[model samples]
Target: MPDSRDRKARKRDLTPEQREKRQARRREKRHASPEVRFILDNNTRVPVDLRPYSLNWDAARIGDPSYYVIGLAKGGSTLMHELVRSLCEAAGRTYIDVPAALFDQGVEPARAVLDPDWLRSRDGSVFGGFRWLHPWMDNLALHERRKIVMVRDPRDILTSLYFSHAYSHVAPETGRLADTFDEQRTQARAQSIDDYVAGPVSLRVFRNYCHLLALTRMPDFRSYRYEDVIFEKRQWIRDLAADLDIRCPEDRLDAIADAHDRQPEAEDASNHVRQVAPGDHVRKLKPETIDLLNRRFAPVLAEFGYGTAS
Candidate 1:
């Protein structure tokens, strides 16, 4: 019983015919080309310059029980990874290597979460974007509600770092143990947990840790020590797993130790390794060099309990 003017007003709104036509148009657009589809999907971006970088991760791929290893340079993370894998293997659970997984981890969520935006903001302003990456990098967000933590030791860390960088003789992959190992790391290969002492890698790793601290306000952020891992393996691992609300079998840790014994003799083959071994650094380090390391890495070492002992 509406008048002509009212009916005209109603007609101006979306009507049955209008709705049908609009829906038809949307249906057509759904089948459109990739380029057009992208334009439609990414309309929220402001007029920012499109750099070679981006933070376009999906943050939803990794499973709930997943973990991230935020190890600093010279930390015993490589051994940690091997140990974790051995444990996970014994439990019949899978532990993906974070260091190497960033490069094409053969999974859909890995793809989405490793996008442009997240890639860009990993560390300093220089490496922000899809172009930059950390070896063995794993997005905490991708873990689909899993746990992420860092483990390290204080004295051994400084000792290993000193040898890792300015060794008048230490040369890893990049050069003779100089600035970085990244130049030689394969873009196709995932991160390596064993490359703990490869230059200033921890400098970058710490930046990532800072980012995580800012993003997640959770109280249970984790940091473990290599000593505890070596001495109180079961208690610590079990505690870590419990913090993450899961059951970690101690037998897996034992298996990891056994597996570690089976690896290359490279660990025991070199003097550099020997110098950095537990108790050796304290005995061998020149007083000045020890002071220098303690000074430069004081903050990190303190967090890991270095100052009180050596």
Candidate 2:
């Protein structure tokens, strides 16, 4: 009659022999190529190159013309990017997608579009900067810059991240970023949703969620929910356009909203775009896992108004 949390604790208290037996069963379920998992778990593999995201920050100007769409990973930042880009087009401005790895201190700004000064030089163009962190806005700033920060229910964010990593971790043909981190081995070795929630990726995401919540409190940034963006694209666009001083004609804003109004796709068992509906974690996560996350991220949930964790 023990609940899942109690059962999980009981398993952890098993004797040595029983522990070995449990591990043996886990090995039987794992489908990874042996060598890669060994290297990843043991830290023997070469590190994946993430240098492509080097953020060589430059000096800020007083009147630099730029706008930023900032959000956590899998938190509708991509959709925010598209919405901002569409606004730029409607306003006769150029949309510049900033690279994720722009923090590298030494590299020169090779691309003209990435240079804030170069962007300033071009008339009728706006820098549509998309990044996760707030400090990224410091160096690229001008007096006229605007920032739109997006947030999502952390439960949905966690669920989406799990599926994304789940696909990336085990499926080699999918060519996912998870493969880069684990060499495509970890998920095949995953035992359950409980294990996945406690995995390295989820822990990192938790840290980021905490960090992002703190950053969101800073002044001069407009925040919106992922739900609002999904259910109210037109009003969201209008609000964003107004903040950025972009005079998006009513028809153009409607057209952009209509273009993005396609319902969440249904065939995405991979959960790609299929069910962007919120609260996916309710179905995908076990009771114990939810309790664990609730305890760990209680502050973040309360900070963002997702309701206080008990």
Candidate 3:
């Protein structure tokens, strides 16, 4: 009923406490909404449909959740998993390979949602080998548990992915997943690295990095970079073990790090350990492609302290 000037005057007349209360009420209303949306830089909205899962805090307490080590694909997850498994062995704890089990059954991380009951049953276990964060993982009631996320430079990730798919990664002789890998290999071989990294095939990798950043928003989640994990293996292992409450002798930790510290002298496309050096993209990708990747991944680079493209 009031005119525009009258409404503006009323808004300006509100006291600080009144304004704070209004903002709090708006936040509460927004949190009460069922749909959750994440807005990326290019005005792309990723809608997470949370309707199927029970997001209630009480429901999340169905079982005792294990510690989780999540990684971005081709981001040193395999090594991290091995290190965690070694630590678990030293600590006399169970290490559950969730991803490997799922992979054996032909379920890739992108195509699978972790079973709440299965997770609930694994009390006091160390769960490793996860490479993707699905929205359904939010259903887990592990707010008090320690979760580790590993990430790498997006450009390096793309370079490694190209080589892994086109050359090194092994695929089974048959199955839908094998067929999918075959298609990827064929495409990777047919296209230049620049085209492959900038094209649609690499979009999922970018999305995974976005999800990794989002997961870091949680109080219990800590993110580690692949560079640090590689260059500073002993300290990284020590810090991670302390965070997970795993007690191991310093000598044992040193032994584990020493066992995996061997780096290849040169890039070998046929082997999984192609190269461990950072900035491989500078050597592999075109200048324009690297510039485009920097702009596209500016948020991740800045957040993770990788330095933006010049």
Candidate 4:
């Protein structure tokens, strides 16, 4: 059989423009709703006062989340997702895959494929994020209610991402696995040394984390931490349940064990797993490299309790 990567190449690798086309179709579908149409075209011209009409009856009537879990990759976001999934299952509450649309096709898929009425308030609905999640959360008129939002300390997130990137895209399956934290730097140096020594993983992680942090600035959001999830699963779930105004089940929250046994290892599924090991990158990254990452990602690193670089 063909390798899994090869399968993904055909099934998932869509170009940016192709994704835009998909989103256009999804938006067209959303626009077809009478409520959406009223809000868009005639909201300004309405004779009655606008504030009451802006209310979200759906969120008021049936409680199902359409919120985003915005956080850096490998920042325990995936495990948090599993925990939330488990909570919903335990309570027998429907997990609605937010019918909201997506634009980009990479971390986020286009909204075009989602039906305007395609809400799955049943159990175990898998919702795509990094696209649909952002927009859905931002639209105040279209309330997602609330869901879990988590962030790990940047040091831990940096470590996990570094190693994961190395194995997933750079390292080989054969004899030698080069954790070249000095990726592309050793060769391109003498001219653009700073550029060469710069870590790609650090750059991506910092930027995405900063973006995720910005979401809490929006109203109706609840923030969390990796430490809280790891150390206080029950409290974490309770807090999340309160924000979402949903009942969290006792059986759903599980203790943090060597969860890798129950799930895939970071390196094995780092690129694609729903959950990844936090801070595994520390082993692969050298001390100097960590310092370099600290400097490069100081903004987000500081925000996540890593403190300012001296």
lDDT of 2: 0.57
The predictions' CA RMSDs to the true structure, in order, are 12.4, 21.2, 12.1, 16.1
**Tens-digit per-residue lDDT, 204-284, candidate 1:** 445544544442455445556655555555565566445444455567655445545433344442343433235445664
Worst 10 residues of 4 by lDDT: 101-110
- Give the per-residue lDDT digits (tens) of candidate 3, residues 64-123: 456888877788888888888788767766566655644544444455454454454435
Give residue 238's lDDT in candidate 4 (0 to 100): 65
Model 1 vs. true fold: TM = 0.48
Best by TM-score: 3
* 175-238: candidate 2 lDDT, tens digit per residue: 2232353642456246465676656656766777765665566556778888767888888889
Q: lDDT of all the models against the reference?
A: 0.40, 0.57, 0.73, 0.45
Best of the two (3, 4) by lDDT:
3
Where does model 3 exceed 4 Å of error? 1-65, 142-144
Clash count, one per candidate:
29, 12, 0, 2
lDDT top scorer: 3
What lDDT does candidate 1 reach at residue 35?
17
TM-scores for all candidates: the values are 0.48, 0.63, 0.76, 0.51
Clashing pairs in 3: none
